[model samples]
Target: MHTGDLAVMRKDAYIEIVGRIKDVIIRGGENIYPREIEEFLYAHPKIAEVQVVGVPHERYREKVLAGVIPRDQADPLTLEELRAFCEGRLAHYEIPSRLRILASFPMTVSGRVRKIELREEPARER
Candidate 1:
């Protein structure tokens, strides 16, 4: 049973699924889970939806990239603003370094987000 899910066992034998192994981002030797970051970003009032992915980095192995769909298209979110929101909340290394405002994410026929498409897009640096 190889479900790609990464989980942890608690003292009570309860299983907690943190994220998927394929989506883990290794930045500067740090393991960053995109699912955790996505959960945190959902707290933002302006963000309607978000997908986090890793992009190649020259120095670090990879960097976090967030593709967001804002609740209000007229008022777009900024990288600095997102950083400010994440500051102190999430680990500094886990914060998204790049941001892409997308109207809608690429989805499969099953209605699942196609993160592979997002990873293929050119990352925009702030």
Candidate 2:
């Protein structure tokens, strides 16, 4: 099933899968929700879809990161704007430390998002 469908089914069953069990980042004692960040990005008109993941951090143990796909290919949103948008909707700790804009997400044969691969894609070059 699609993520949205699964989410609705889970809600109906009263089972809340807070985050991808494997994607939750423990940074400085905080539990960061990557979905929250992705949802915030989805609110923007320019964004088509988003995915957020956790990556290892040298100091804080782990850090939040985001990958975005734009609805309009020519007018992609910037990382700073995306971060600012997220800041308005999320707690400080939930904001992503790194952001990337992609043309499309990698998907499985059945069309499920390949989140494991997403989590492993190298961070955008600074």
Per-model C-alpha lDDT, please?
A: 0.93, 0.74
Off by over 4 Å in 1: 123-126
Residue-wise C-alpha lDDT for candidate 1, range 1-126, written one tens digit per residue = 999999989899999898999999999999999998999999998999999999988899889999999999999899999999999999999999989999999999999999988887754432
lDDT of 2 by residue, 16-91 (tens): 5556656667888997767656767688888889888877777787788787888888888887877787775788
Backbone clash pairs for candidate 2 read none
Looking at model 2, report the run of 10 residues with the lowest lDDT sum: 2-11
In candidate 2, residue 101 scores what lDDT? 78
lDDT of 2: 0.74
Q: In the order shown, what is each candidate's alpha-carbon RMSD?
A: 1.9, 4.6
TM-score of each: 0.93, 0.77
